[model samples]
Target: MSTKYKFHEPTAIYFISFAVVGWIDVFTRTVYRDLLLESLSYCRKEKGLNLHAWIIMSNHVHLIISSKEGYLLPNIMRDLKKYSSYRILKEIRENTMESRKEWMLYLFSKAGQQNSNNKNFQFWRQDNHPIELDPHLNMFEERIDYLHNNPVEAGLVANAADYLYSSAIDYEGGKGLIDIDVLI
Candidate 1:
């Protein structure tokens, strides 16, 4: 609820991070991660989301995002999160192969009931913790490095570019899961 971390500049690129409620490792599955990637793709194609970079970790995600001339970054983020949450939750509910279905649903239900903003279930934590990139400093490079190296730091992969869920591959001149406007 603090204005310090809110999205104030609509056009300025932002380094944003959001986690699942209780930091549950919901994205451990390929289907869940692909669902998030699909949502990002939809936002980019329909909502004027200028995605600079992104990474989907086991429990959270980080993105370097901005918006086109007539779009608002906050609005795009809200829609992206809301839509992805609904779709992912539905998939989890309907997935007969999901072993953690009941447990995840219970946690989401409990979280939703506790938060007045949600009607039934809560998938993502509310705050995006967006930090506008300062052109005066090296914030862009710094954040992009941090974002790409997350999997490496977590021991998920030996090399950053080897992580398929991140933009590191794109940065390394390889095609990644989602389209990104690589920063120079």
Candidate 2:
């Protein structure tokens, strides 16, 4: 009944999705998307996050991640989401170029008011829907393919590898926008 994704296995790799409140197309703006990228980079470098794959869509993000030694997945996810929400919301509020600023702020503010956890804004919805990739199942490739092909399925790109915000290029042996530990 709870809308929270809890990672049970500390060492296991997880495929997690984070969505925005009201499914807002906040990532349609380049500034916001770049901020999310910076947040991920920070988590990877300073927080000991091991990112296997990642993609930032218009309203949601998919990440295949794990934590290194001395870290926990839940804790890492918590920090990543919390930090990203504040920074993204602030950027949206301050960005004059954002044409939908008022509408976006209203939606985020309303969602925040409806939730007991948030004080002012709610950028990301609470649930991450983290799925631990079981070693026996070996669905790693399947999930990575699904993540990379999301933009293609939505008709945003002709090929999965062409998506700039994803790790698909890395899987194809090219460097991506962000450094990721390629699983496939």
Candidate 3:
């Protein structure tokens, strides 16, 4: 099943989520997580992306973002997924700390083999569900709050700010790895 959405305009905020194939816990390693962070940083610096909020979970990611130059949202997600997949797979192969590398690669390879044009294991699912934000200011704030609160909701941390991989710290006056552009 293809998971793609069409946006009629480019000026609105978008909420996007992409899950690991089979919902695997591939992000237990900090190396893979760092790869994602690095990709987001590169995107911000080179792609004109305006990242408003984000949360990197064990198996998925939630992001609230918009493009300053009106670039299509799908393109941004595609690039992010592709880059992260390559780096994470390479890390899995090269890093000695990843004990479950074989099993993870088997699962990823199985999923990739199920689909055409996949030469190796697939990390992320291809479908990105992008929800167009309501034009109201309050609605945007609510979505941002929801994104930031995800880790707390999952019981991973006591507060949103405690989660190092999200923009909640930035909102709470702490420095986050990625710079966030506040919408409100």
In model 3, what is the error at residue 167, expressed in angstroms? 0.3
- Which scores greater on lDDT, model 1 or model 3? 1
lDDT of 2 by residue, 12-45 (tens): 9999998998898989888888999998999999
The C-alpha TM-scores of every prediction are 0.98, 0.96, 0.93
Residue pairs with clashing backbones, model 1: none
lDDT of 2: 0.90
Which residues of candidate 2, in runs, are more than 4 Å off?
1-4
- In model 3, how large is the Cα lDDT of residue 16? 83
| Model 3 per-residue lDDT at 7 | 51
lDDT of each: 0.94, 0.90, 0.84
Error of 2 at 46 (Å): 0.7
Error of 3 at 178 (Å): 1.4
Candidate 2 clashes between residue pairs 3 or more apart in a chain or in different chains: none
Top-scoring candidate (TM-score): 1
Question: Per-residue lDDT tens digits of candidate 3, residues 1-184?
Answer: 3434655467777888889999999787787888999999888778767899898999999998888775766677778889889999899988887889899989999999998858878889977778888866577888888988988899999999999889988888888987888766
Superposition error at 107 for model 2 (Å): 0.6
